[model samples]
Target: MATLLVLGFSSGLPFYLTSKTLQAWMTTAKVDLATIGFFSLVTLPYSLKFVWAPLMDRYTPPFLGRRRGWVLITQVLLLLVIAAMSLHDPRTGLKMLAVNAIAIAFFSASQDISLDAYRTDVLETREMGAGAAVFVMGYRIAMITTGALAFFLADRTSWNNVYLLIALLMIIGIAATFVAAEPVLNDAPPKSLAEAVVLPFADFFQRAGVLRALVVLLFIVAYKYSDSLAGSMTTPFLLQAGFSQSEVGAVFLGVGVIATIAGVVVAGAAIGKIGINRSLWIFVVFQGLSNLTYYGLSLSGKNHGFMVSAVITENFGLGLVTGAMTAYLMSMCNKRFTATQFALLSSLMAASRDILVAPAGKIIEGVGWPGFFLITVAMAIPPLILLPFIAPWSSDVPIGAAPHTGETIPARRPQPPLAVRR
Candidate 1:
């Protein structure tokens, strides 16, 4: 658990520093919103992590075996890139920042792949949910520190200094890689890069049933759609809500970050007691209903009291949902394809909005705030309706694979028997 937590920080801290944090710096420097939004697209590397993940899976890194060695390589590069990011001025060198942000994303995505592989390798099936809960709490803590803390610091210190501090923190992950032992997998390393690359998909699709497989895929892709939509609009929404800039920061620091952490802890305990699938249902409903709280705030004429309450409810619900969902996602992946498989699943989870969510402000302009919130809430329906098919966590499938479906694997054979791959 301690290792996962440190690994989470090692992986997550720079994620937003190169993303939304950089956007704020650009915004302050009088960059247009469109250009700032363009910067957000740099995160595509995360969604596409599967593209290079097989390389990590097929061969062990020289220093630390399969996972840790890759993690160390990425962490060192991440530190260097983050330090380089400090040298670029947002006003004069936005292009340079964009390039650097892409570099950070590459390393961060690699780090995430290593962590995912490590997590599956180290923990037992029964213990995975708990491990996931702990790792998420750590990851969310990193997000809170980087996202909220950097926001606070930007108001005080320069963006460069904030970034430099974040760069220094990457060392924790580097040292952890040296110390945290890698697990031994008896399975042979991939026979060839093609097999390494192609077999995971073949295994997953061939194993899980077609209908069930589609259901899982849809759930993965749609689960975060509404949240993504609302998130793309949130800062703009808050800014327009008429709170002073400092007050906005105060609310995020006070209500948003704090409630979020509390919610994660509460959800972690709930999962331990009730189990992952059941907790997931509760979390889905919590997230959907919690999103409606935003509607109430919008209609409350931007009342500060209402605003604070809504922020607390929304963020708290988000923390719980995010923590639970992460465990669920981990449960879904096959261990052999930890990097590519998870990258694909998470990409499905994130791709739609990562590409399309930016149109949110424009969508709001067409519909107005009240209507926009309602529409965003409505997007939750597809995933919510599909939840039943997913729960009892696919009663038919065994542990370590999705059930009742078979698809073809490309490299080995033409007619593969259907097997559920976890």
Candidate 2:
């Protein structure tokens, strides 16, 4: 858990530096909003990371074993690249700044591929929920450090110095890598790049059968749709509803952070007793229903108490849903193809947030804030309907039983059979 926490922080630190923090630097340097907006393209590697995931699965690094080796290499590259950004002035070095930012994104995305696979490979089935919670907690904390804390530092010192300090922080990840134990996989990595590329897809489709595989993918996309949709518009809703920026930021930093962490920890423990399937049913409902808090706020105008309640309820519910969903995704991965398969699954999950939510503005234009939130609540229903088919209320173990547990190289992991018996 401690290892995952540090790795999660490692994964998140570079993310904001290249994107949000970089933009802040440019804005201060008198760069136009248009260029800053275009800079968002630097983050493309994250969405497309699955394309190269098979290579990591096929090739093992020379030191620190398979996953750890890749983790260390990426961490080193990230530290160097982020530190280098300090030497470039955004005004004159705009092109070079873009290049360095892209480098950071690539290394960061690659690190996530390895780090996620390592986490999936090492964790016991029973530990999945708690493991995901701590990892997310670490990831969120790192975001705060880069986002809020970086700006705070920039106010006191130069942005260049802030980058230098953040770069030094990567040593935390490097130290963790040295001490972290590598996963003991019973199967050898795929022998060829071709095999690595072909087999992960073939294995998944074969294991779940074509129909069930499609449904599982659909479930992955739909499960978090409402949350993504509502979240994309949340800040705007709060601002439009008459709350001040400082008020919203304070609530998010105080009540929002505390509630989210509390929710994740509570859900992690609950999943152990109630199982992932049951936790999903409960948490997903809370996640969806929490949108009504915004609906209530829209009607009430800017009541401080209502805003606090809304932030707490929404953030806490999001934490619970995120924990359960991550465990469920981990449960679906085959150990041998952990990197490729997890990348594919998580990318599709990202698509739900990035792509599917693009239409939110148009939808809200038609529906208004109160109606928009109500629609978000309604969007959560389809995934719940899918639960009976994909997860089933009575099953304690995951759909494919406990994935990555007690398996030998030659033993074929059991998969959900082709037919769903009603």
Candidate 3:
């Protein structure tokens, strides 16, 4: 549990450092919004991580086992690349900074793949609910550290120093990697790179059937669509709403994050009591309702107290849905393809909003904040409509079950018969 916690921190730390937190740094340096907006392209690797997830599954670094080897390598590279980014000036060396930021995203995405696989390998089926919650708690904490604490530090020190400090935190993951035991997989690994890349999807389609699998994929894309869209411009929204940087750091980053962690904990308990399928329905509704909280903030004008209320509502909802979402995605995986399958599912989920978010500026321009938030709430509906087919409230799919298998397979992993690769 402790190992997973630290690994979760490592997985989340680089995310905002290269995206939102880095944007904050550039903004403080007086960089143009357009340039900072364009920098978001560097995070594309996250939406494409499934493309390379097979490599982690197919090979190991000879030091740690399959998952930990990739985890260690990615963490060390992340540490170096992130620290190196501190050497460049965002204004004078914008191009160079872009390149380094992309590198950080690459290693960060890779680290997430390994960590997802590692968690799947290490945790028992019954433990997945609590494990997902704990991992998300650590992840949210890292976001606060990188997002809030880093912002606070940058206010007092150089942005360069801020990056360096953030980079140093990677050592905690590295230390955890060294201390953590490698997962024991008794099944034979993929016979070749080709097999590793092809079989996960093949197995999934075979088990779930083409139409069922497509529905599942669609549900994954729709589940968090609004939340991601709303989140993509949260900082910009706060700034434009007349909130100061410190106000955002305190309410959204500090107090909001705490509320989010609390929500995850509560949701974890709820999952155990209600079962994951039912939790998905309940939590997603909360996520949709939370969008209204932002609308309220928009209507109220620029009050810090209202901002805090909105932050708590939105983030707590995010935490609730995300905890259930993580477990749901894990349950979709066939354990044999934990890295690849999870990557594909998560990447698709992320891509749904990423594509929509590109046009967010235009949408916000047309409708303004209140209208934009209403659109977000509307965007969440398709997924709720989908839950009946893909994850019906009465369904009994065990937490972390292998694809179509209703029964949990422990220790020795088994692959359901593969479908023909089309």
Candidate 4:
């Protein structure tokens, strides 16, 4: 569990460096909002990471076994690149900054791929709920560090120093890679590139069938669309609304971190008692309705109380929905293809933020903040409507259940000799 927590932090830390926090820095630096919005493209690697997940699965690096080896390499590269970010000014070196930010994102996404596979490999079915909750808590905590702490620091120090400190924090992940044991897979690693690339999809389609798989895929893509759309401009919105950096750091990011952790813990318990499908319905509603807080904040006009309330509501809902969704994704993977399968699901899940929300600034310019947030509320509804078809209230599917056979499907490939972790 400690390993998962550290790994999750490692996976999440670099995210905002290239994203929300970066946008905040740009906003503070007086960069145009449209350019900041376009900067969201740097994170496209996250949405496209499934493209290389096959490679991660097909071959083991020479050190630290397959998963940890990749984790170590990515964390080290992320540290180096993030530290290098200290040298570039967003004002004078916007293009160079973009390149380094993309490198951080690339390594960050790769780390996430390895960490997700490691979690899926190690945790038992019944343990997934708690594991997801723990991971989300860790991820959110990292967000607070990079989002809130970085904002607070950037207000006082140079963005360079802020980024350099964040780079130092990557040591937590690197140390974890050294101490953590390599997870034993039930099935062997893929033998050929063809097997790595093809079998995971084949296994998924065989287990779920064409129509059901499509429904699941659609839900994955749409479930978090509303929050993501609203979130794309949240920092800019707060800045425009007359909140000081300290106010946003304390209220929006700080309060948000606490509320989200609470939500994740509560949602984890709820998933155990009520099951994932019903949890999805409940949490998605929480997430969807929470968007109204932003609209309300817009009307309330710089009220700190409303800002605090808004951040707490929206972040808590995000935490609950995210925790439930993480467990749902883990439940879908077959052990042999855990890395590739989860990458595909999570990549699709990220498409809303990484692709669909990239144009959010243009939308906000057209509709105004309240109107833009209203559109996000509408975007959140379709996924809840999808739950009946993809993850119904009454269905009792187990992990790795085959649709046609109605039997548990074990890992297809045979186990090879265990790899040692350094």
Candidate 5:
């Protein structure tokens, strides 16, 4: 659990550095809204990481076994690339900054593939809910460091200095990598690159069938769409609304962190009692409705009270939804193909954040903040409609179900080993 937390933090740090923190830097550099929106494209690697996930699965590095080896490699690259970013100024070197951001995203996405596979491999079936919560807590804490702490530091020091400090923090992840135990899987690693790539998809489709698999993928995409759309422009929105970087950081560090942690804790506890599907239904409604706080902030202007309320509500909801979603995704993976399958599922989730929300700048310009937030709220509805089909409210266990649950029955019978099938 401790290892998972540290790994989660490592996974989250580069993420905000490239997206949210970079947006903050660009906003302060006086970049226009449209460019900032389009800049999200740099994170395209995150949305397409599944393309190379098989490579990680097919071959193990010489040290630290399969998962940890990749984790260490990606962390080292992230450290160097993020430090490289510190040398470039967003105002004068916008294009160069974009390139650095993409590199960071690529390494970050790769690290996530390894980390997710590691976590999936290590945990017992019963541990999934608590593990997701702990991982998310670590993930959100790292976001606070990059999001809130970075904002505060940037207000005092140079953005370059802020980036450098964040780069140095990668050492923590590297240290955790050394300490983590390599998971001993019952199944062997994929025998070939072809087996790694083709079999994960084949296994998924075979398990869920074509129609249900399509619905599940759509649910993954839609579940977090509203939050992603709204979050894409939040930093710029807050700055444009007359809040200083420190003030924004203060709120995030204070109520935002507290509320988010609370949500994760509550959702984590609730999932065990009510089950993941019910937790998703309950948490997602709040996730969507939380956008209204931002709508209210847009109307109220720079009022700190509204700002505090907005931050608390939105982050709390984000925490709840993120916890539930993490467990759901983890539940869907087969042990042998965890790296590829989880990467594919999470990449689709990232699409909503990066690709689908890329039009947010144009949309915000046309609709205004209030109208734009309304659209985000509406975006949350499609997934709710999908729940009945993909995850029925009455069902507690996930589709494939994690192995070794004595009480819960898997929706489908376990298949023979890949070797046997081949």
Candidate 6:
């Protein structure tokens, strides 16, 4: 779990550095909103990450194990791009920064593919839920430190120092990868690359309904819509609320961070006590309700305390909601196609946020805060409506039965002898 936590940062740090944190960098640089908005497009690689997931599945990196190789490779590239990103001015080198952002997102997405695969493979069946919980706790911390602290640091120090700190911090992942043991596979390895590449696609398509896949995609996209769309406007909103920068950091990044960790911890415990189904429904509804915090803050005339209260509540709900959600998604993937299907589901899930949420600035500009938030609440509806349909569709487990979620389930052959390298 400690190793997973470190690796989680490798996956999560690039996310903030490229998205919200980058926006903060640009706004300071006097870049225009339209141009800054264009930077969001750099996240395209995140939504389209499934494109290269197959390559990761087919080819192992020469140095690290298959999973760790991709992670190491991406980590190296990430440090380079973030460092390069630090060197350029978004105003004069906006185009160059855009290029760097894409590179980071690409590397970040690849890192996700390998790390998630390892997390899934390493833990036992029933333990998967717990693993997801721990991993997300780590991911959320990375978001806070990278997303919130990076902004806080950039405010006080040079963006150069902030980026440099984050780059070197990635060494945690490198070291973790080296020390960590490889995971046991539940299924037989493909004898050839074609079987490796071809099976996942066939497995995905051969499942029950065409509309089901499409709807699953819709759920993936919509479930996160409210959160992501509302997020784009948070900094501006906090500024408008008359809070000082320190207050914003201390509130959302500080207390909000603590609350989020608490929520994740509680959520994991809840998932263990209650089954994933009950946990899912409860958390999903809680997720939609959490958005009301923003509405409350907005309607309360942006009171600083109100903003703090709202952030804490929303993040807590998110920690609870997301921990269970990932476990559910894990239960839904076929072990045979774990990398590809998961990448597909996860990328689709991110698309809901990155693609759907990009319009937040426009919406807030057009509709005002109250209206924009209400629209965000409306965006939450599709996923809740869609979850029931998806909750029943198991790519890994059958419809009526719960997943083989508990136990190691006894492997026929113990995980391929670590002594032999393919």
Candidate 4 lDDT, 205-301, residue by residue in tens: 8888888888888888899888898888889999999999888877755678788888888887888787777888888888988999999999889
lDDT of 2 by residue, 1-422 (tens): 78789988988888888787888899999999999999999999999999999988998988887888899999999999999988999889889889989999999999999988888887877778888888888888899899999999999999999999999999999988887777778877799999999998898888777888888899999998988999899899899888899998899988898898888888888887888899989998999999999899998898999999998999999899899988888888887888999999998889889999998999888988899999999988999988887788898755653356622221133586799779
Candidate 3 achieves a global lDDT of 0.84
Q: All candidates: CA RMSD in angstroms? A: 8.4, 7.8, 7.1, 6.0, 7.2, 5.3
Error of 5 at 355 (Å): 2.9
Summing lDDT over every window of 10 consecutive residues in candidate 2, give the lowest-scoring window. 405-414
Candidate 2: stretches off by over 4 Å? 406-422
What TM-score does model 4 achieve against the real structure?
0.80
Candidate that scores best on lDDT: 2
Error of 2 at 103 (Å): 0.2
Error (Å) of candidate 1 at residue 331 is: 1.3
Give the backbone clash total of model 3: 0
Q: RMSD, model 5, all Cα superposed?
A: 7.2
Put down candidate 3 lDDT per residue, 256-296, tens digits, no spaces: 87888988887878887777888888888889889898898
Q: lDDT for every model?
A: 0.75, 0.87, 0.84, 0.83, 0.86, 0.73
User: What is residue 12's positional error in candidate 1, in angstroms?
Assistant: 1.5
Q: Show the lowest summed lDDT stretch of 10 residues, model 5.
A: 404-413
lDDT string, candidate 6, 1-422, tens digits? 77777777667878888888888888988998988887788877777777777777777678655666777787887777778776887768877788888888888888888787777666654566577877887887788788767877877898878988888878877777777776544556555677777877666656736677677666666766666776667778878877788888678768877887787777777767665666666776776777788887888885766787788887887777677767766765665556776787787666765566777888888999888878877766777777677664223332322234322322133576568667
* Candidate 5 clashing pairs, residues 3+ apart or interchain: none
Residues 162-228, candidate 1: write the lDDT tens digits.
8888899988888777777666565576778898888877777666666777787878777767777
Listed per model in order, the count of residue pairs whose N, CA or C atoms clash below 3 Å is: 9, 0, 0, 0, 0, 3
TM-score of 3: 0.85
Pairwise lDDT winner, candidates 3 and 5: 5
Off by over 4 Å in 5: 19-42, 82-102, 147-165, 232-253, 292-303, 358-378, 402-422
